[model samples]
Target: MSADQKHFSPPARLLHWLMAPLVVAMLFIGVGMVATLSSWHQTLLAIHKPLGIAILGLVSVRFIVRLTHRTPPLPNDMPRWQQHIAHLSHWVFYALLFAMPLVGWSMLSAGGFPIHLFGPVNLPPIVPQDVQLYALLRSAHTVLALLLFATFLAHLGAALFHGLIRRDGVFSSMAKGRD
Candidate 1:
């Protein structure tokens, strides 16, 4: 209800939403690439691998900016429990964002698959093929993706909870920055 609070810095706002589409897109592409195995497999991998790497790079920059820049504090009126949930959810997002790509890369590498980025660049493989480990990592990575989706829903619920019930600008702080 007050007009005195500051909004997120422009860069933080930009990256916040900018990363959303990429994450969702990567999740879909990743699933497609994993579910199919045939002539088209390599083609999909070519597209998916680079895109995942690119997302990882951008998230890295966003994390740095988030740490170094000034983010508007939670509206003072928000409950302490809500603030704690927000903080925990944010860290969870960061972890999943980072883990998904790394695990994918490791899974592929462990399968003796080549990682071809957008062009000539090749990502270094983390391990040699081990049938058992590849299966294990693939399962873990899939579970993490599902967790990301769940956390994402929780994040949305909180945002709506704030923007509607609380009549606060918490959602707007990030949403106001148009992609």
Candidate 2:
């Protein structure tokens, strides 16, 4: 890899940092929506739907950026197994990022609920309403969400390992961007 490819492009870095907190917030807000029975439930739902859609949109752009840009390579000293795991984990992240929102949207669609973005804005249904389909989609969403959380934790651990323990430039490639 060339020296110029050692760090992510500015837009890629911007999107990564921008989406990180939002994704974390979405996870917590999802939990809050499920746990609460009061008015907060509705409020959380209100935030959740739009946020999911926003994530979907951003990830789409991010994916395009990923396809076009040259990603930094793993350090030469890193083990082959570590390199494989890193690549696998990234694909998993992409899958979860794209799937989660689509699943949620499909779940709502199956439940015959209009996705109110904000105010009068609403998204049209993506699937025909069916109770069985709704149940299936809901279950899928929950399971995938758990997987997403687990993968996120793994990703975090790996980032910390690179950033702190290894003191490698891998973390900085994304965290600090090109200098």
Question: Which digits, one per residue and each the tens of the lDDT, describe model 1 over residues 42-156?
Answer: 7777777887888788889889987987666788887899789899999999899888889989999988888877567888898888988899999989899899988988987
**Cα lDDT computed for each candidate against the true fold:** 0.81, 0.93
Cα deviation at 81, candidate 2, in Å, is 1.0
lDDT tens per residue, model 2, 1-179: 66668898888999999999999999999888888899999899999999999999999999999999989989999999999999999899999999999999999999999899998999999999999999999999999999999999999999999999998889999987556
Worst window of 10 by summed lDDT in candidate 1:
1-10
lDDT of 2 at 114: 86
TM-score to true structure, per model: 0.86, 0.97
Candidate 2: misplaced stretches above 4 Å? none
lDDT of 1 at 40: 77
The per-residue C-alpha lDDT of model 1 at residue 34 equals: 75
